[model samples]
Target: ITACYCFGALLLVVASICDLVSSIQLGQDSGAVLSRPANSSRIFYGVMFDAGSTGTRIHVYTFIQKDPEELPVLDNEMFHSIKPGLSAYADMPEMGGYTVRQLLKVAKKTVPRLEWKRTPLVLKATAGLRLLPSEKSQALLEQVQDVFDESPFFVPDDSVSIMNGTNEGILAWVTVNFLTGHLYAETRETVGILDLGGGSTQITFLPKSKKTIGSSPDDYIARIDMFNSTYELYTHRTCIKYLLCHVIHRPPYIIVLLYTPGLEWRVFKSSCLPKKFREEWSFGGLTYIVSGKPDGESYVGYKLCYQEVLKVVKDIVHQPYELKDTSVFYAFSYYFDRAVDAGLIDRTQGGMLEVRDFKKRAKEVCNKMSKYRPINPFLCMDMTYITCLLKDGFGFKENTVLQLTKKVNNVETSWALGATFNHFQNLKIHR
Candidate 1:
C-alpha cells in the first residue's frame, strides 16, 4: 500500500510537469517559464479555464516545491484565450462545449500521456454566465464539464460553475498582491484592484481603517484567511453593461428585442448616446441595435453624461471612507483596453493615470462627436462611464492614481492565477 501511494504521488508530479512544459506553444519554447534547475525534486501543474464575458481563457501553471515545509514556488504559466465566451453559446450548449474542446487540444498536445490522468481540470464562468438564467447557464456549464470528463485530465465534481461577483474581486485582488509580493511580505500593505468588464466591474481593497467597513453595507465586507493572515476586504460589484442594456437599441425603433426572459418590445433611449448614430452590436449571444436619436441633435458631453450615469450610480454605490486617505490601486481589463483606445496609456506596457485623466479624455472624445469614429459609438459613453464610476460612484478623488496593466511577471494579472493558486495552494500527499 505504501509503495502504491508513493508511486501515485510521483505520477502526479510528472503529470503536472507535462501540462506546464507543454503550454509553451506561443513562441515561448525557449523562455524561462518552463525551464527548471536540476536540483528541483517536486513539480505540479494546475489548469484553470476562465469563461469571461468577452471570452474564455485557459491558464496552466507549474510550481516547484523546493522544501517540504514551505509553499510551492511558481515556475511557469501557459496561458491562452478564445473569443465569444460561453455565454455566446447560451442557446447552443453543444457549440459552447466545442469551444472548450478546441482549447483543450493545447492541453492534450502538451500534457504527457502518462500524466494526463493526474492533472486537475476546472472551469469557472464569470459575468457572461451570471447574466444568464440558471437553467441556461447550468446547461452551458454542464457542456463544459462533460468535455472535461471526456478528457484524460482529472475532473472534480464541483468544477464548473458561475462564480460570485465578490469572490471574483477578492481573487483578483489576491492575484495582483500575490504577484507583487505584498501578500508574502512582512508588511500587510496591499494594493487595491479595479476590474472593468463589458458586462460588469469589481472594486476590491484592503481597508486601512475599520470605519471604511463599519460605514459600508454588511454584504460589502468579506473575510479571507490567506497564507497565515486573515484579511478583511472591502469589495463592490456593479455591472455597467447592465445599464447599457437600457440604451442597447437606438431610440424610435419598433422591433422585438431578445433577452434571456424571452423577447420583449420596448423603445430604449439614453442621453449618453449620440443624437444621430445607429449601431449594431452583439454580446452574450444577443444582438442589439444601439444608436443616438434618429430625429434630434442634442447636447452630448461630460456634464450631461455624468448626470445621466450618476442617477443610476450615486445612491447605490457605497463609498469607502479610507479611499481619500490611501488610494493605491491597479486597474485592468477594459480599463486598460479603453485607456489604450483613448491614448491615455501605452498598449504594450501600461502606465499610471489619475482619475481626472479619464475626465480629460472623456471631454475630448465626447465633445468631438463627428471626429469620434462611428464604428465605436460607445467610446464616449464608455469613457464617461469610467469617469463617473470612479469620481461620483466610488467617490475617488481626481488625483487618485490607478496603475493599469494587462500582465504581471509575464502572466495575466486577472483572477485566473489567483483561482489557480486557490485550487493548488497546499498539498500534503505523502511521497
Candidate 2:
C-alpha cells in the first residue's frame, strides 16, 4: 500500500509540471501572436479612463499589429462619461461621493466580461478637483482611494493626479501632430499650443526639432513652457462680497430674466457662469423655466441661443463671467452679429439666436482690437486667431498650420494617464 501511494504522488507531480509548461507555452504563444506581421485580427485590448470636472469616461482600445517591426495600430476604441456633468461637485459637495460611485459602476457595466479582469484602467481627474481647497480635495481623494481599494482590478485607483495646464497644452500639441502626419522627420521650430476646456484653458509653448541619427531614422527634440490662468475672475473676498450683496438686494433684472422664456432657470446652474448667478436664479423660480417640464423640445434651440445672447449681453455690459474677459466677449458678439448680417441667424425673429459667421467675425474683431492697447496683449489673439495669422499673414500653408492646431487641440486623457500606470507597472516588476 505504501509503494502504491508513492507512485500516485509521483504521477501527480509530473502532471503539475506538465501543466506549468503548458501555461508558459501559452503565454509565449500569446506574446508571439501580438508580434505577428500586419493583420486586422492581431489587436489586443486595453482600456483608459478620463475623470474630469464634467464627467469620468472609460475608453477601451484594441491595438492591431501593423507589421513585424512597427508598433501596433490603435484600432477600435469606445468610451462613456458620467452623465449630466462631473462639475456637480463644485456646487453640491454632497454629490461628489455619489458621482464617483456612479462613474465606477458605469465603467464596470461597459467593459466586456472577458476584458474585465485583464484590461488596464487609467483614472485621471482635471479641473474640478484641482479647484477644490487642499483639505477638501485630500478628503475627496481619500474617499476615492477607499472606494477603489488599490486593487489591480480593471478600474484604476481613485488617487487624483492631474497634468499641469502647460503639460495639457503640450499633450494637445503632440496629439495633433501625430494625427495630421505632420510630425516632421527633420525640422526645428517653436509651436505654441492653447487649449480651451470646460473649466479652464491652458497655453504652452514648445520649442522642438527633428534630428536624424544613423539607423534610427528620425527623432523629435522638444522643450516645453506652460502657463495656466484660473477662470475665476474675482478675488475670494470680492466674490463673497458680491454674493452677499446679491443675496440681500435681489436684483430685479435677475427675476425678469429667470421668469422669461428662452431664458431658462437652468441657465443659472451652468458651470460657465459664476456661482452667484446660479444661486440667485435658483432661488428666483428660474428652475421652472429652465427645466422645460411641459415642453421638452421647446427650449432646445432657444435655450442655446439665449445663452449665447446672454453671454454677449454680459460682454457688452463688461460683467465678469469666468474665463470670459471683455475682449473675448466682444470678439464673440461681433462674430455673432456678423453671422446675423450674413443671414446665418435670422435678424427678424428676435428671440434666442445662433450666429453663422462666428469665426470670421471673431477674426475681424480681434484684428480691430489688436490696434488698441490692452492689459494682456496675448488676449487680443487666441490660439485660433494666431494660427490664422501664421497661415495668412506669414505665408504658412493653411493645411500645415491647421495640422499643428488640431494636434494642439486633441487632448486625450487616456494616453496621458496611461503613461503613469506604465511607470507604476515597471516599478512593481523591478521590485
The per-candidate count of clashes, in order, stands at 0, 6
How far in Å is the alpha carbon of 274 misplaced in model 1? 3.6
- What would the per-residue lDDT of candidate 2 be over residues 1-431, giving only the tens digit for each residue? 33322222111111132221110001112121223344543334444445655466665444444322333333334555675434445445446556666565554664456545444445556555665566665565555555555433444342345544334444444433332233332342323333434322233333221111121212222243211111111111011111222222221122222234455433432211211222322432333222112233233232332443343233122111222111111111122223343333453331222122333443443343323213222222222223332223222232222111111112232234233323222221100
| Alpha carbon RMSD to native, model 2 | 16.4
Task: Provide the TM-score for each candidate, comma-separated.
Answer: 0.83, 0.44
Candidate 1, residue 312: the lDDT equals 64
After TM-score superposition, what is the CA distance of residue 270 in candidate 2 from its true location, in Å?
A: 21
lDDT for residue 221 in candidate 2, whole number 0-100: 23
Off by over 4 Å in 2: 1-42, 66-70, 83-87, 90-97, 105-112, 150-159, 182-192, 198-200, 205-359, 363-431
* Residue 131's lDDT in candidate 1: 74
Candidate 1 lDDT score relative to the true structure: 0.71
TM-score of 2: 0.44
RMSD of each: 6.4, 16.4
